[model samples]
Target: MILIGQYDSPFVRRVAIALRLYGFNFQHRPWSTFGDAELIAAYNPLRRVPTLVLDNGETLIESAMILDYLDELAGPEKALIAARGPQRRQCLKSCALATGLADKAVSLLYERVLRKDHPSQIWVERCEAQIGAVLDALEKERAAIASPFWFGTRIGHADVAVACALRFTGEAHAGVFDDVRHPALADHASRCEAMQVFREFVQPLIPPKG
Candidate 1:
């Protein structure tokens, strides 16, 4: 398998981390959507990161889709997400919120960097507010969970998703997002990052080439 995209992207990073956790061996392209648009377009016309090319010549686009495929590959017992019931719903809900937060952070970054000369203050403010709201909600949810991982002793999709999002938001908007303000989430991210999988797959943030 070939994993295309820079780890700076939370979406890509989460997928990469999950692949490692699942014990999959694949090549890392580390391609940038901006710097390697044509290359990525060859596989994904959307030119999005986190595009996974399987050995059988199948390609997967979008982190969620790739993750779902991975969970299926891992089978019921070892899948990061719960297979069904209320547990699955809660896990999916957390993953949704975390990824949504990441999407907003990425948008804010593009708006600020790509349109620096004429960025919309309204959009920036809205994104900032949404980031804050998501952080608050996630922090509370995490605080209530006394287990080592969000779902239990074993780490799951929600844990990875939230950790990746928090890492990106903290770095991309360091001035606005203070770890001290979201202690529970901060701690959760810290624990995740300390793991070898996260440390090995990590990359520093790089603004898109405009």
Candidate 2:
């Protein structure tokens, strides 16, 4: 198995963290979507990061799909997500919120960097509001949970997703994630990031291009 993409990407980082936790031995290619678009396109025409090449010459695109396949490979007991019922729904919801927040952060970053001269304040405000809303919702959910992870004692998909998203949000948009404003999420992210798996696959945010 091979994992492609820079760890700076929250999507790619999540997948990489999961692979380590699952004990999969694979190659890591820190390819940038901007600098290595053509190379990535050979495997994923969309040229997206977090593209996983399976052992048997098959390729997987998108972080979610790659994670689904990995969970299947790990089987029911070791799967990161709950196998059924309300547990699965709750986990998915949190993951959705976290990933959505990450998307908005990325979009806002592009707006400022790519359109520096005429960035739309209205659009930027909308993205900031979305980011804040998601953070509030996640912080509330996290605060109500007593477990070290989102799902009881064991870490799960939601934990990884939220942690990765929070890291990216903070790195890409400084001062956006205030520890005082969102203490629960701040603590949650801190714990997850302290893990060896996370530390092993870490990368600094890529500077924005003009």
Candidate 3:
């Protein structure tokens, strides 16, 4: 298996971290969508990161689809998400919120950094509000949980997604997301980052040049 994309992206980072947790041995391409657009497009027409090349020469695009495939490969007992029922719904909700937060952060970042000549203040403001709302909701949900992870004692997809999103949000929009206001989320991110899997796959964000 080959994992293509830089870890700076929350989407890619989550997939990489999951591969590590699942004990999957694969190659890391660390390709940038900006510099390696053509190469990535060959595998993913959308030209997106977190593209996974399976051992059988099949390519998987999108973080969610890649994760679902991986979960199946790992089998039901070892899957990161619950097989079914209320737990599955809750887990998916948390992951959705985190991924949505990451999407807004990336959008906000592009609006500010990529659109230097004609940046839209309105779009930036909307993205900021969405990011804030996701953070507030996630923080409250995390605070109510007594377990170390989003789902009981074991680490799951939601935990990885939230941690990756938080890290990317902080890196892309420094000083915007206040750690003081989200103590639970702050602490949760710290714990996840401390894990060996996360530490090993970590990469710093590299904003586009102006």
**Count: clashes, candidate 3:** 0
lDDT of 3: 0.94
Worst 10-residue lDDT window for candidate 1 reads 173-182
Which residue segments of model 1 deviate by more than 4 Å?
A: none
Residue 143 miss distance in model 1 (angstroms): 0.5
Residue-level lDDT of model 2, residues 1-210, one tens digit each, is 999999999999999999999989999988999899999999999999889999898999999999999999999999999899999999999999999999999999999999999999999999999999999999999999999999999999999999999999999999999999999999999999999999998899976698
After aligning candidate 1 to the native by TM-score, how far in Å is the CA of 16 from where it should be? 0.8
Whichever of 1 and 2 has more lDDT, that candidate is: 2
The alpha-carbon deviation from the true structure for residue 79 of candidate 1, after best TM-score superposition, in angstroms, is 0.2
lDDT of 3 by residue, 7-65 (tens): 99999999999999999999999889999999999999999999999989999999999
TM-score, per-candidate, Cα-based: 0.98, 0.98, 0.98
Clashes of each: 0, 0, 0
TM-score attained by model 2: 0.98
lDDT of 1 by residue, 1-210 (tens): 999999999999999999999999999998899989899999899999989999998999999999999999999999998899999999999999999999999999999999999999999999999999999999999999999999999999999999999888888988656678888998999899999999998888977766
Rank by lDDT (best first): 2, 3, 1
